[model samples]
Target chain A: MILTVTLNAALDVTYRVARLHQGASTRVLSVAERAGGKGINVSRVLHTLGVDTTVTGLVGGLTGRSLRQDLALAALPEALVTIGQESRRTVAVFDEAAGETSMLLEPGAQVTGDEWRAFTARYAGLLPSAKAVVLSGSLPPGVPVDAYASLLRLARGCGVPAVLDTEGEPLLAALPARPALIKPNADELVATTGLTDPLAAIEQLRARGARTVVASLGAEGLVAVTPEGRWRARPPHRVAGNPTGAGDAAVAALAVGLANGAPWQSVLARAVALSAASVAAPLAGSYDAVLYQRLRDQVAVGPFTQL
Target chain B: MILTVTLNAALDVTYRVARLHQGASTRVLSVAERAGGKGINVSRVLHTLGVDTTVTGLVGGLTGRSLRQDLALAALPEALVTIGQESRRTVAVFDEAAGETSMLLEPGAQVTGDEWRAFTARYAGLLPSAKAVVLSGSLPPGVPVDAYASLLRLARGCGVPAVLDTEGEPLLAALPARPALIKPNADELVATTGLTDPLAAIEQLRARGARTVVASLGAEGLVAVTPEGRWRARPPHRVAGNPTGAGDAAVAALAVGLANGAPWQSVLARAVALSAASVAAPLAGSYDAVLYQRLRDQVAVGPFTQL
Candidate 1:
């Protein structure tokens, strides 16, 4: 079973309208909401893929109730820890005419030192039973920057592979704890490692105590460097669709592969395929199973021979 | 005691942001929410004025719970009927830099016939305890067009005066039932009666089932034609601000005045004063008590002689 943690879970709401005008009332044609956050999305995808996953995080207030209700309605596994602060609502306004989506993200939860202690205590109890632990998304307010680092250490102590998918300081801080695998998108990769070359960037990450590094290059595909080998994987053709959740889908695939002890080449192929399939699907945490199967067969994984 | 019915209540949310850009992620600085609807706003103001007011309407599901929670937190009075459907959320994104507000209104609830029956049964039970009844806002889906008309008849049967505030077909349909009073803004007047002349339009309304007619002229003032007399009242100076809830404020004053059995001139003066005070305040369902006092003393109410 995979355990995913999303400290800043949100109720993701989408409003569909013909067009959005500035400073004018927009009558939403339709409204849809889902439980969302990075690790929650990961857990949802893994659950959809028939994997045993449990999602644990802080949820509170009325919006928290709504998010929990959404998770229950979807029958996705959850073990949310309650807090005092209300959870956030992330709004996406979709314009049908222009085919554009504008988003408004509420600030993350403000977990106090005591709440963090409570969360850590709960997390410690669950780490032992997990095959892998994936810590995803940004650290909420009041949570220390070293949060992911401590979690990774605990997972390592339990002999659970810790997959870290984040960016900036938190990712930087967690690397020294030696997360089993780190997945950074092309932009996040450059931003964090400051190296233009993917291989050099992965090398820098490894030097920072990362065991394995996987970088997502958007429509381009996946690049990885591991102890066994280094490989590059690409989709036969780019799927031109919303790529918002493609990276998360790749992370889910990677975590799934790591749990199953799959080879690097096979893991890269699955990551590239599932991610492209995610882009094909409209929803963020979902993919077309048929498209995924076809893309899995079509994705090419080869040795990283380029400089 | 007064009774206010909001057939389509909502959880009104306001988001404060530095700016809003199309197709971009906006970080909201703050969020505030409350229970809202036309009659709900009236009930709130009435409660603030120490009037014994019970707000009755349809409320259900998560959004309804949020609205009810807000009302409870505010300690406002309510007796909302529960349904299987969830209530709506009306969001106003306030751009602090430009001082402009963009609203996104969720579609109204699709109430079932059984739900409407339930609401009517509840409304019938509450009518006898009220000094007056206010039926406000649009009729939700699956509710009959004659919903207000039926309610007005029930109020009249219970010897209670009914104040009707709405637009188009509902207003037209309710006129023959002769609600004790009907309040329409200038635009609603033009749309419903197709007459630019406020006095003539109001007279037409009085001729159709409204015992008394009051028309709100934005920035200009208010016009009233009651059997006792006809009067027009204006604020000493226009209060320039977002007029989003100005009309609702005027309705609150009107409901308060009618419940007190104030004379036409006094009611018109109070409505004009309170409406301008509402324009000065940032939120709807709120007025500047000091400004209301000052304006109440200074407002000029005189006989209306049409051009």
Candidate 2:
């Protein structure tokens, strides 16, 4: 079973309104919410694909309770650790008239040193029964900058392959532990490596100690640099919808492939197809199964070379 | 002790950001939240003034739990009834650069017949020991339009005075129940009675069965038409800040005055002073105690004459 860790889990809330006006009150017509975070989204996508995934994370307060309730309703297995501070929430106001969405993200509560110690202990306990572990999303305040690095070491010690999906310092800090795979989106790749070229940045990431580097270039699709081989997988057509959870979808596919010892070409193809299918679905963390099936064989996977 | 009922209570959350851009994600610098509703605000002000006030209404789900937790922190007494649906939340994004606030109001959850019945039973149980009852704010979906009227009947049966603060159909529907006092701001007065003139609207409200009508006219102060006398009380100077809970502050003073059987002039003066103090405070459901004291006796109270 795959174990997913979301240190900064959130309750994603969407408010539907006719129009949005700055500095004025907007009456929301409808509200929908669900448990969300990078790792949780990966587990959600894997769950839908009939994969065994357990959601483990730090959660607290009423918002945490609400997130847990949503996960239960979705029938997603969880082993969340409790904390003292309330969890954060992201509110997206979708304006039906303008066909736009504006968002406000609440900063997650600070995790104490004791809480971090407790979470690491829980992660260690879960890693023993896990085939692969995925650590995703930004670190909340007060957590050590090397949080992912510590978790990666634990996963490695347990002989579990680990997939890291994050950006900036946390992503760079975790590389020394040599995670099995790292998935950074186009923007995140440039921000982390300071290289505009995807192939060059992927090379830098691999040199920094990642066993495999899979970079998601939004509409362009997946580019992988791995030990076995290098490949570039492109979607047949762009799916125009919400791209919130597309990266998590790719990470889920990569983790499954890594656990099953799949070929690079097949793994890249699945990642690109699943990513596009996720964009086709309206809600985040969900994908259109029909679109995934339709695009599965259509993704073009070929050898990658530095231009 | 005054009993305040907020049929549509909410958790009011404020997010502070450097600037707000439409159709973009804004990172909130800080977040603050507390229990809120018209009647709850009234109860908060009354509690601050050292008045004995009990907060009662319908609450449910996790958001309700958050609200209740905040109420407990504030040390406000409560006897709220539980329901199956989640309570609503109102988010206000304060843009510091532009010095403006953008608000999103979530529609309250639908109240089932059983939930409403349960709330009424709880209200009935609280009314016997209450000196007065203040029913405020809009009705949630599925609640009867004449909900305040029904509550007013119960308050009267228990020999408790009722002060109603609402608008549109609910305001019109409750007037026939002959509440001891009805407080409507200038906008609510015009909207409820369809009269451009405040005095004309207040007269119309009294004719329909409201024992006393007090109209809050924002910075212009307050105008009261009661059995004892008619007077207009204006603040010494215009104070600027948040006006979200200003009217509720006025209702709080009015409820206290009615409970004490105070004269109209003194009641109107206190109401005008407290309302302006509430406006001067940054947070809603709070007032500037210093400003309130300074403005208390300085307010200009004179006999009001309708031209």
Candidate 3:
């Protein structure tokens, strides 16, 4: 079973409007709420793809309660550590006509040291039964920047492969632990390595002790480097829609491929196909199963070189 | 004691940001949550100003619970009626340097007929003990525009003075009930009467059976036309900062004055001063008592006539 860790969870609220007017009130045509966090999103995609996943995170207050209730309603497996502060909420105002998405994110509840300790202990307890652990999302307020490093250490201690999906300080700090895999988007790779080239950035991450590195390039697809080989995967065509959670869907596919013992090339191909299929779905981290199967065989994989 | 009704209540969340760039992520400098709705704001200001006030409104779900907890912490008198749906939340992004505020308002929880009947009955039950009832804010979804009119009918049935503070169809519909008082902002008056002239709009409202009409004109102060007399109260200077809830503060002051048996002129003077003081305060509906008192005596009151 896969374990996903989300330090800062949120109630994701999406509002559909004809257009977003700056400094003017706009009526929402539709509103939808769901439990969210980077790891939660990844786990949701994995579950929808028929993979078993467990989500663990810090949550508190009324917003936290709502998040948990929503997850239950969705029948998602989760282990939430209750804290003192309420979970944050993220508002995405989607302008349908313009196809622009505006986001307002709240810097969720602050987690105290004791709360962090409790969550770490809980995570350690669950690590033995988990085949792989995916650490994702931003660190909540009051959590030390090196918090992910501790979790990485714990995963190593339990002999569990861990996938680190985050950026900036936490991602930088966790690198010394030599996580099994690290997924950084183009911007995150640039921020971490000061290298605009995806190949150099992936090499920089590998030099920092990442066993494998995957760099997700929006429409261009993904470039991955593993101990076995370096591979590139791309979709046949770009699907038009919101690309918000496509990376998460890619991460979910990568986790599934690794669990199913797929090779580097096969994994990259499956990940690219799943990510593309997600863009075709209306909701984030969800895709049509039939479309996913159809596209999985069409995904092209080739050896990655300097270009 | 004064009773204030908020048919559509909200948990107002304000985020202080350096700047808001649409479609890009923003880091909030500070976050604040307050119980909000037109009537609730008035009640908060009234309590802060040492007026005996009771706030009655529809509340539900976790957001509603948070609102109640906040009110309890503030030691405000409240009788929040529980509904099936959760209360809505409003996000206000304040840019300090530019002195601009962007707002995202959510359509509040829908009120069922049974819920409306329950609240109306509850309001009627409290009428015998209430000195005056202030029906404020917009109607929630599922609640007809005539909801306020029904409340006004109940107030008239009990011989209780009802002050209506609303806009659009609800305001227009409640006017024929001949409420003891109605406070409409300059924009609301324009929309309701299609008249740019404040005096002409006041005359139109009075002609429609409203006994007293008070038109709030932000920096220009307030204009009131009553059966007894007509008065225009203007402050000596324009108060700085946000004028978001100044109108609610004015309504609160007017309710206090009427409950304390103040004359029409004193009500106008106190309302104007209180509104100016509210603009000076950080949170909406809050005012400096000393500043309000100092400005009260300096307010210019004169007969309002169309020139």
Q: In TM-score terms, which candidate is top?
A: 2
Query: iRMS for all predictions?
Result: 0.8, 0.7, 1.6
Which structure is stronger by TM-score: 1 or 3? 1
lDDT of 1 by residue, A1-307 (tens): 9999998889999999999877889999999999999898888789889999999999988889989988888788788888889999999999888888989888886888999999999999998889999999898899999899999999989999989999889999998899999999878878988888877888899999899989888888988888988888999998978787888899899999989898888889999998999999898888888999999989999987673
Number of clashes found in candidate 2: 0
Q: Model 1 in CAPRI terms: which quality?
A: high
Candidate 2: clashing pairs of residues: none
* Residue A114, model 2, lDDT: 98
- The per-prediction CA RMSD against the true structure, in angstroms, equals 1.4, 1.2, 1.9
Question: Mind giving the per-residue lDDT tens digits that candidate 3 earns over A1-307?
Answer: 8899999888998988878776766767777889988899898888887778899999998889989999898788998899998888888888887877877788878899899999999999999988888898889999999988899999999888888899988898999999888899999999888898878888888998899998898888898899988888888888877687888888888777666677888888888888888888888768767777888888889986765
Question: Model 2: per-residue lDDT, tens digit, A79-150?
Answer: 999999999999999999998888899999889999999999998999988988999999999899999999
In the order shown, the candidates' DockQ scores are 0.82, 0.89, 0.59
Ranking by DockQ: 2, 1, 3
- Clash counts for all predictions: 1, 0, 0
Order the numbered candidates by TM-score, best leading. Answer: 2, 1, 3
Model 2's lDDT to the true fold?
0.92
Question: Which candidate tops DockQ?
Answer: 2
**Candidate 2 docking: what grade?**
high
